[model samples]
Target: MTIRTAFKSMSVAELTRKLASAETASLLLALVEMTGDTAPLDRWGKWIQGPTPINAEFPTAEAEEIRAQVADLLIERGAQTERLSEDSERFRALTAAATDRVIPDAEKPLVLKEMGLLDEAFVDWSAVRPDRADQFPVVIIGAGMSGIATAIHLERMGIPFVVLDKNDEVGGTWLVNTYPGCGVDIASHYFSFSFAPKSDWSRYYAKQPEILAYLKDIVRTFGIGEKIEFRTTVQSVSYEEATQEWVLEIRTGDGPARTMRAKVVVSGVGALSTPSVPELPGRGEFRGKVCHSAEWDPTIDVTGKKVVLVGNGASANQIGPAIAPDVERLTVLQRSPQWVNGVTGYLDSVPEDEKWVLSNIPAYERWFRVRTMLSMNDVMRPAATVDKNWDGPEGTINEANEKLRERLIGYMRSELGERQDLLDQMVPDFPPMMKRMLRDNGWCRMFRRPTVELVTGAASRFTENGIVDEHGREHEADIIIFATGFTAARMLSSYEVVGRDGVSIRDVWGEEDPRAYLGLTVTGFPNLFILYGPNTNIGVGGSIFFQAEAQSTCIARLIRDMIERGASSAEVRQDVFEDYNRRLDQEMETLIWSLPVGTTWYRNSKGRVTANMPWTSADYWNMTRSTSLDDFVVRYHDDERGTAHADDIYRELDSDVARTH
Candidate 1:
């Protein structure tokens, strides 16, 4: 039923029940803030004092009647009737009351931007018009989250650009990683782009197919399909110093290679694209069906077969519970344990009434998204900070870390009951959030099953028919699933990138560690920007979509500035790049990931924390909001040649968007 009439069908008791929910309470607080109607909030008594615990229910019939009245009033005065400015006092009050934390006025702006409450302040055409926009074309490397967002904004500004991807589809990680029980860890609402909200999420944490559908819908809605080149791979990117242009060599499938030149290049190939497979001693002669989690083969069924799943990280944690029931016997080879949280709505579906409210309300979706984002972002930050004076166990960084460790242990104990062996294997020795924490996907319950076996020791080597652990025990298995994670530390492995003076990115960054200026621009790569680069991935909270959008907007602005000023190329200064990396490294030393030193994908071979950003998501957003011209050396058209490229009215191959240079 539609939202307008859905409310009319609800009885008073049902409405009261809906109102009693914590989601309803927080949403009502948002409603009151949006319209300045205190009637609904006043009806709740002191229940709205802080973040209402999910267990809190309406006490008496009188309270139910008041809540029903508020619901009726809300339906009568629809959200479309009024709009709330994010900077207003009422909005701040709503934020604080809904979040159950006092946010200072100084931090509101950053919060607003991170929450997507602020306006699109990235581009200002009035200050610097896109006069030479058509002449200067841009080439975006991927058609994923970052690429799509960049395309959308560039389309809005009437800039000419082309999106190329190696896959036959979009959605990057969402498209590729399709193992059983695959889904987003963050709330689906906050996981999406802020400018575009989805009202039809099946659950709070959406599954992979639903998210892929969302991205496909975005492409259709924005009419970006005509400009995207699917099944096209960029082989190498070389900067032409003489012409001040980026020469990209691309090949589509097995077709012949072709070259395209653009004024600027943006790399949107995310970090987790490459799969990292361990080199087992007898992997080749195992004579069993072997597959990585990311590259799951649908044809190879594990029904009633002996399965040995390697790695107990995020992917392994998910795969074990999903395939254990059907398999004859499941052996989980664990190198180390992970701390998984039992979230409230992790397994629940989105109710009909919540969907109705979100669809019907104007500002309600934004406020709800902000509430979830704030809940995930900074609430657990303090637990990861190091207190210098306070001595703590080697397993934990500080007092707060130790307390969190105990709470997690308590949670594990409650779930597993007297199964000390399971607890010992499940709980990590290090503090929580040291690595990417896993969400509870029935991981503990899987251990209780008779068919499942949790092996604590690391896999020593592979045998002819099975695997051997470090303790010299052999377990025969028909199939081996490497739930081992991706090569996240290997940034931009899709293609070769050469910068000024013909220097390859691999030569500079070696095999693993990659450093970039602001995680967007490298020092020597002129006119080349990146999304989801080194030190940009969030550890504790925040969505990668949010980070990608921020980087896209920043790059778009810098490219616009160059196009407006008739500049041929712009490279981040070397000294500025070094100084920023130095500060970033120093800051990394203070984060929890650096302490209690565990082996994680977040660090490189040298033990440098390359994957996670040390600061809050808000800090990264503030740093990338705008570009400083002084930090870059821009080469104008005059430096490249006396005039622009001789070709006029250039048409991009396989593209509807054409440009005249």
Candidate 2:
């Protein structure tokens, strides 16, 4: 039966079930929006009231007309959405409808990139000549989300490249983090890479196994697995000034180190590689199973055993609720409470029919993903901006921030019910978005359970059997799980990098405060590109996948230009680097993440915001759309001389020679 005929025969209950599914919510919402019918929306509103109103009926006379209209519209528009163009009426209408803003003509390119409306390429494939492809050999570090993206783009350009990852698998963070209830906080569709969109996600928020399986599947499908060298670690990269090549020292699984060469080196080593273990005194004295959330020990059994989970953060939040029911007693030690945002469809699985609609419908998945992308990231951004006029206390930063705080606190209170102490412990004093916004995941409900206890204090030290609080209270445990997050500030601290004249990256960025131009290129480090670098983490509202894709395209364009122009190396000038960083620092001073209300991993030890970008994902995408050669100094191997520029030359001696005093 046809879609229209099939829907016409369905009962109201069946129709409601179809509409209420996570996969169909966006499509139904879009239809209701397009029709401007409030009845369908009201019915949807009731559906969000959850299981009680799942059988809600559409009360509008326009219901049948709208459904048929939506079906016809999907069939027609889905066939025409083959290319990226703002001129497409459906594209423009969908864009305006999804964003609820007028997108100017000039902004269409950026919007298209952000929406994955076009093929993943910053430069045309025809622009890259075949002969030069072999000459532009590239090496990418890490085979995670960003690494594979870079490799895929480079391979498309016919550039020979190698992917090196320390782990024995494709997924970087996903491979290591096996804690129970581990899953992406972002919606599954938006969390994935734009070029390889998936329609058959089992869960709305996919779990670790599903995510890893997806990445591994991508690697297998794209044949990226052949180019990847697993269990191989990149130790250090030094620039050989004469050959203009990056000399990489690699160690593979306890073997002796070996050196390799590549004209370009891209580091996709993300910020979360190194796990941050808290410096609790006598930690080594604990005579029990000790493990961090990232390095979860599946061998250790937690059934009917007392567990002490230190650090109340994202990992702790997910781990707590998953293990709370099975453990005899659970203690969650927190230094400070975090603001948790409750998502409605957090625990729901995608239905088979909805998945079929997504996979079969041509542009349905893209538009739905576009709608979800805006909802997940763009909507919460304004709250991350500081409002100078309105005066508020530590609980919030602005009017928007205040409204969010009130809503979140109300959620906690409602979840806690009669347990006011748990509510008090869960309500955060700092503004939202300052730290990572955690998913509620029934965390407050977990605290209300009789088997669980929430302790708000610094962990002083570990005794022979358990952890001790600062107040001299001891919490005994069978296993100690450190949910403490990664060392975010140290982006590439473990590896050594020598640039021009033996200048190390540490020497430029210091031990902890690493800075980069556009969070992609570094000054004096010729042909070295980085993804997920300093100031690139979007805490406000965006995925690192978007950032990584943009950066990969940017890096690819730079390499293409270098090969086409016959340039030996291109490096960001010192002045441009300083100017970009200066503007970033100034802009960050006005954002909520940089406020002095509380501390987050987004900032460095010196209280500077290092890991987060100040701009929106769209802005960053625009900035990296193409590389401007004016910002960098291009060098040639045959010239045997450097170009004379104001920033390149030290004119102190020249000034003294010309002095007439």
Candidate 3:
């Protein structure tokens, strides 16, 4: 029933068995918290040497011994003490000892908050009465991960809101991308929401079904399902400046489109929602069941069929290997090679014993999450930064970048073993992190299969039976699957967003190059927020869930501020929005993606880095930790403040600036 009661029921033998499978460092820190003893840290501190999850310097025997000691200590004193205290100094010391890295004073607060040791500052919903909150109705688009996260925050704040998704169910991307071998590249713990950590993930990197199940569980647990209107698509959102509300045109399951009103609108229809199927010459000529990876038709069987997979990005890496054994011939067409890092246990299921520790241990799950967060949070950022002085190869950015390149090459060589031809095709000419870094899912090994072939050319045209390459070589295929990623640069390309003065978001952003102040708000948009928007995608480190939570918190806080201040609308100041994007572009010039690396979705048609945030996760966290009222021009209701307008306030501020100058 209760966590403490459940944890107390575990015997010493069971605890020891489970602990043996757990990370030694996580166990040690959790033990310290559970037992109020620092003895385990002194004993095992030397064994932890790096920031990664694989930082255990001890041998297998020694690790088992440490687990045994921790189990005994937990059985002896864990139940008696309800976690020692919220001791920050002790936490900082224990974290350092556990991670074996110096936790900087500046970064400790963020680290603490991520670790669940410190709670993030949320709006005191009690400050705004329920009746007042109801006046500010919110409408969220897409019942995906970001949408679900935003809804949870609103639900917690007791704000009246409804989630609209085109799909029949939740789990936006996960629900849509049902291709074989669809799964997460990041570790299961890190990919999930920090607040709703799943202790019993089936695999180290969970597949689609499990991921979807997890999201559905969260919806049920938080009671977010009833508030969600599934099979409902938001066609357009137009801001009503006169009434300070958003007018939404939505369609439910082929029904007649209807209009609704909301005080605020949040766009969670992420960049990855729309599949980017390239328009090749003679695409209609192909006489086969062609499908994009995202819109995979499950009924179409690939067994004994010659399959042509276009694009060797994250999705193709998984799909190629998964179908290689079953398909008669698996031809992977590549425009350019992606930098893939080999992760140990990429396909390994989480051991039952390990799950036991995560589920039952007092502070083990939190510490384990912290370990993963610390390990992944900007670990490869140094490799992504350009070092202009040091001269290396064309692909290498800096010393760290070159080192990563060499290490990855070594991994490919090892995996391909004697297959020099395959290794040559696998390595990319651009620097690491220029494109999304993929996790090795037997992609290198799949090439060794007799039935599999890696074609190093783009599709020139589609024949009646197959596709012709750039060199005019035809590859016969019974089925063609486009693993060609999504329209990521074009944010909110699905629906129309009409902001102030009837200016369309599409008109402002064009085909791509969407910019938002802090990737949450735009200058013309009032009481509107974007989650997983422009420049919010984590390129080198962190997950989208992290960005979503931070952005949701920021939006929630801003809405709360509006409710408390009795404001009709809150729009980001033009100067603030322009200044933020200017700084973002300036920072983008220093990142690896800005270099003339071959075409990547991270960059827009204008050759600007539009998809990824130039800053580290911690940097973004600090920037969005709180909303600055000064950055936005808040417009009060006509009754609250007679005839005061946002435009009038901006002009007055501009006049004051002119006089000061």
Candidate 4:
């Protein structure tokens, strides 16, 4: 047998051991080594001797030449550098490394199992009621990632579904977020469909155009675009039990109104699409170009223009340093400092050879996908937790957060050089997990820019020309980008949802917080399944796509149960939903998102935690794999067959397969 045959025969542990010792990745790298094409990475000059540490220093005299070369490379690729650095080379390396490192060691089976990537997905895959055929029609709102993904599974089941979007085209967040510096923070390779892996990626962290292109590619590949009704916004959605369908009233941007009905309604509008502008005394009076980063106007030229970026969330963190290079002077106005942890693969781009391996090597792509998921979910899971018992500051959590703080501060001190004043202005006061933790190179590098100004104080009010700071300093600018972010605290609040007995979803969640049993179904909403619904957000921070897939699969099973039972809907038992939420809240209270100093969107006005799901991604996955009647009370349309669907939920299956789901 050839070496290929021998390598394939060894167990994963042995392969890993061989891989670790080789320095080269594996058989693939060895093949490249034989060709002598893989040069000593340093010769490329992509890396340099320590300015501080790895790559920063090039001989001082050569700095001008290198900087000019870096600029030329950046102009060719529309990518962010740390959102901090505009240089594409390092980010390219990270993307390359991420593609390599994304492959997991041992849990290919488990990762494949969770994602239904295995041949034996017969059990888990059967949860979607494809066999019920035309029993129910599914209507989806928002043609974004979550909605599109849900439709893909539904299509595989042969379930009739249509996707509606407010935009002129599909690609929800990816479609709308067309800002200059906008690109995905997640590695482009893994920030996509697990079912469909791409071997052709030009950038490690793809820009908006590339990200949008990926969506369009998926739409074409899956044949979902034809099912989508673009530029049609959902006006109102009312659930009707008599017919067991949703009354969807839609309004097109052209002023035409239409109505449709479907058994299931899924919202992929996402919690982040709507731009949340801060209420100020004088608004909209800016003479020059003013727009939210989400709704960026490409026509607005920032060259030589004084730009003022409001809000230092993810968008501003990226947009600030991104446009700063082109602008005359850029000023960033921050509300509260957000914790920005360093992410490894954000800048790394995958090489063509590695892409070839990921594509042709069978399990290579799957293992890499699993590895990225595990890196995001399993490895970083603990970082989101708050240890209240350990003695620390009111805002800061225990040793872990302190370590994160120190790590961030260390980076700040290094990046800031000798400027302690800038360091004091840059560091965050709130705990790590309070707000959505961002990973950006831009935040650190923003201060390093000579023309960039970092103002720590609050924006007291908006002036006719610029933003006025709390200390009475006016930030003069011709261009303003509101990176203030979205109203993520309010989930499902954008839609007009009327559940059983005319219970408004907004009214129900009024003044308190949003809660859902298993984060899939609500108690009052029977036959209604929500994907990426209330409290479903990963609190500790993981991929939402994982949660989306799990939730969609879990709900698909419930839908299957309802159809099998001859019932129109699935409803969580009031008590059961309440009890589950109680546990979730209890978990939240223990975490950092619950503390006094922890003022964030994760919590509501009443000091109740709202946005995040406190459980581990694995825990959430296992809990949602199948449904039990004990967790919910079902309803049948017929008066005589009341709650029959509840009984049918757990009909013991003859097949060992159904038992697992």
On TM-score, the leading prediction is 3
- Clashing pairs in model 2, backbone N/Cα/C closer than 3 A: none
Query: What's the TM-score of each model vs. the native?
Result: 0.91, 0.88, 0.94, 0.80
Query: Least accurate stretch of 10 residues (summed lDDT) in model 1?
Result: 645-654
What are the per-residue Cα lDDT tens digits for candidate 3 across 222-273? 8999999989988899998779899999999979999999999999998888
- C-alpha RMSD in Å of predicted model 4 compared with the true structure: 10.5
lDDT of predicted model 3: 0.82
Stronger candidate by TM-score (2 vs 3): 3
TM-score computed on alpha carbons, candidate 1: 0.91
Arrange candidates by TM-score, highest first: which order? 3, 1, 2, 4
Candidate number that wins on TM-score, 3 or 4: 3
Q: Any runs in candidate 1 off by more than 4 Å, and if so which? A: 1-22, 38-66, 110-117, 121-124, 127-131, 640-661
Highest-scoring model, lDDT: 3
**Native-to-model Cα distance after best TM-score fit, residue 232 in candidate 4, in Å:** 0.9
Q: Candidate 2, residues 1-661: lDDT per residue as tens digits?
A: 0123244455555544443443333455456434434355444443332111123233454445444555665444432334546676555554554444565666666556555666544454434264756877899999888998888887767889999999888998889999988998888878887777787898888999999998998887777788988889888999999888999999999999999999999998888989999888887788889899999999978899999999889999899999999999999898998998888778889887677666654355666776567666555778888888868766777889989998988888888877887777778788888899998888988878889999989888999989999889999999999999989998886689998888999888887888999998899899999989989987877677788788888888778766655566889988889999999998998888787767798888888898888887777887887446557888767655665332343332234322321
TM-score of 3: 0.94
> What is candidate 2's CA lDDT for residue 591?
89
